[model samples]
Target: MPHLVILYTANLNFPTEEGGDMSGLCRALADTMIAQRDETDKPVFPVGGVRVLAYPAAHFAVADGSGDFGFIYLQLRMGRGRSEWVQQRVGAALVASAKECLAVLLTRQAVGVTLQIDVGAEVFDGKLGNLHPLFK
Candidate 1:
């Protein structure tokens, strides 16, 4: 189970150029996650459990109190049981995809992007949903 959450400043609205929308960025990253594979060419994450979400912070302060500065923070949380190599590979893919998706926005504005991965440490986790059935 791998979930990617993105948080960005509200001022960093989607650029006017193509592929500059928030939904498109989320979808592209999710697609990138779906395409990841291990050293043996096995799927990195279960498609049924893969999720991507993005939210804009309406209230926030950027560096130097400049409202023109924008930043995007991406965090991928997943259950433990994968090799470091696999994790690195997945991280690279996700970051590359994100950069590509935000290319237009980056050029037009001052943007900072950060990607982080959080491995399992869950004391308790539970889920109840029909989405898994659709994937199965």
Candidate 2:
């Protein structure tokens, strides 16, 4: 399972004629993650377990007080047990997807983008709902 949390500065205006909407960006990122495949060419992540959410920071200071400075931070959480190489591959793929999604905003304004992946303890992680059927 993988959950993506997007945090962005409120100074940024989404859905601008120049920049795309945040909701759309989130969906693209989620789809990108779901498309990831392993060495065997099989889906790396469970399609039904992918989730993407975004939060706008109402109050944030980016390097300087200049409102022109914006940022998008992504926190990715997933179950443990993958190899280091796989983890790196997934992280890189996700970040590339994010960059592509925010390309317009990044080129038009001064924006910082970052992604972090966290593998949770298998023992503590719990799941109740099922979206697997939909994927099947």
The predictions' CA RMSDs to the true structure, in order, are: 1.2, 1.7
Candidate 2 differs from the real structure by a C-alpha RMSD in angstroms, to one decimal, of 1.7
Clashing pairs in 2: none
Q: Which stretches of candidate 2 lie above 4 Å from their native place?
A: none
- Candidate 1 local lDDT, 101-122, one digit each (tens): 9988988888889999999888
Work out the TM-score per prediction.
0.94, 0.89
In model 1, where do residues sit more than 4 Å from their true spots? none
* Candidate closest to the true structure, highest TM-score: 1
Among these predictions, the greatest lDDT belongs to 1
lDDT of 2 by residue, 1-136 (tens): 7889999998775548865878988998898888887777888788889999999999898997755898889999988866777789999988888777777777677888889999978676566876778888
lDDT of each: 0.89, 0.84
* Residue pairs with backbone overlap in model 1: none
